[model samples]
Target: MSIPKTMKALVAYSATEYKYEPDYPTPQCGPDDIIIKTEGCGVCAGDLKCQHGAAMFWGDETQPSWVEPPFIPGHEFVGIIAEIGENVTGYKIGERVAADQIVPCGECRFCKDGHYWMCQPHQIFGFFSGLNGGMAEYVRLPKKAVIHKVPLEMPLNDGLLIEPYACSKHCVDRAKIEVEDIVVISGAGTLGLGMVTYAKLRSPKKLIVLDMMDERLEKAKEFGADLVWNPSKVNVTEEIMKLTDGYGCDVYIEATGHPSSVVQGMQMIRKLGRFVEFSVFGEPTTLDWSIIGDRKELDVLGSHLSPYCYPFVIENIANKTLKTNGIVSKSFAIEDWESAFDAATGKYRDFKVAIKF
Candidate 1:
């Protein structure tokens, strides 16, 4: 394949400003690097929140902005290898692949401790200038970037799901669910649906899902959720208590990113239960600290990006065990990125929206 000198991409100029260039210079790969011609790139909620001026992304009075301008803005992408550097041994040109979103500084203390996901000077691809993301026709995978070959049999849209699915696996791992445990997943969105798919593999006592969308809740039932709830139709907490016989759920995974869901999770989780928070909230959420400490004695776990779970995710996708049916609601061309972004931002209530090259 002939590599082009320039390609189309979306570059960030500010929290709310993005430049859609039709012919931006393509990224160059180093000796140990590789390049992929994007097949699909899913627009995540974080991208939308960052663009809408979320303080955590834009930085406010007391914090520094995490996302700098002039960087591409799509992390959940899958592509075919267009170029491979001289020393890149495992990959070949024309292979399908997905790159881990975060590129850690190998010398950092966390990386040295085998927790690369916690590296202090994290340079996430697509957000930082040094590691540009896949919201383009082509993306460069640097030496430090973790790359995994995606099986060709998987649909491109399904393959683009690796990143978020991997994160869901991490969240499930954090919960440490037991076969006898009652698990409740809040939010039947993509991440929550991903959780339901994998959580069922553990064979928990009961798998309950909550969402306001009846359609998503129905999908959850099909994905192996033992029970599904619509907060709009019933008092979720009250119904949960009835289902659990007033004991409350043993494991509560919060993926709604809604402030009320946080409070609801705190109230519905049993004493000494595990509460795994996996959502990237659009704004600060305030809740009573007493429930976490003195009141319930619950174990609160915060889940970040997918770490050490990529291989498992890859295997699931290859095996068709991750439930990709109807997951990708829409795919748009690079020129229609604005519509794609809007659809992905929940303007259309789609499961996932991606840009296809």
Candidate 2:
């Protein structure tokens, strides 16, 4: 395989500015690094939110910006190894692979403590200029990066979905679901559906999904959700309470970026129930804090980026234990990124959207 001197890439210059550069310099593999020839990369909800200057990415009066511009914006990617450094072991050229979204600085306290996902610098691919993402013809993996070999037989869309599924796995793990507990997962988007699949593996007494879109709700059922609800057509709080014999659900996982879903999870979870908050909200959510401590005494947990979950996601995706069909509903060439972005942002009724390189 021949590596290109220049490649097509989506470059983010600012919060609202992104350009598709047809001649961006292809990353070079250092003695301790490897280069991947990108096959496909998924468009994440955070990408869409960052594009519109969401406070979380752009920062606000109370918080600092998490994103550094002049970088490529995609983290869910899969590719073939085009070049391998002399020092890199256990990987060879032409192998299919995917890497964790975050590249931790090994010297950080968090990294030293085995919590590299929360490294102080927190440089996630696609958001840091030094760590370009896979929205290009090739991507470079630093020696410290966590990389996993993807099965060549895995479908392209399933390969691209590895990152999101890893995230969903972590979120579900945070819930600590029991076999006899009733589980309620909010939102039926890509992440939520992935949660449904993994949560079902626990064989909860009942797994319920909530979403405004009937299309998404239908897919939830196909992914092993026992019951699906459209919040628009039904009172989800009352329905969940009724299903739980007025006790409320034992576990509630919030995957919807909407504020209402946060409120709904709080209102429908029983006392001492575990609540896992996983979504990257576009705006601040105002809720009654008293409900968490005074009324329910719920166990509130936060789920962040995928940590030590890539290998599991890759193996399960290859084995078909994790369902991937109908999740990646649309794809576009890198040249048509604007249309892809629109489709990913709900302009079309899509479960997930990807940019093919």
Please give the lDDT score at residue 3 for candidate 2. 98
Question: Over 4 Å off in model 2, which ranges?
Answer: none
Candidate 1: segments with Cα more than 4 A from true spot: none
Could you tally the backbone clashes for each prediction? 1, 0
Best by lDDT: 2
lDDT tens digits, residues 140-179, model 1? 9888888888888887878878998998999999999999
lDDT of 2 by residue, 1-357 (tens): 899899999999998789999999999889999999999999998888888887878898989988887898899999999999999999988999999998999999999999999999888889888899988999999998899999999999899889999999999999988999999999999999999998999899999999999999998999999999999999999998888889999999999888999998999999999999998876689999999999999999999999999998899988999998889999999999999999998768898999997
Model 1, TM vs. native: 0.97
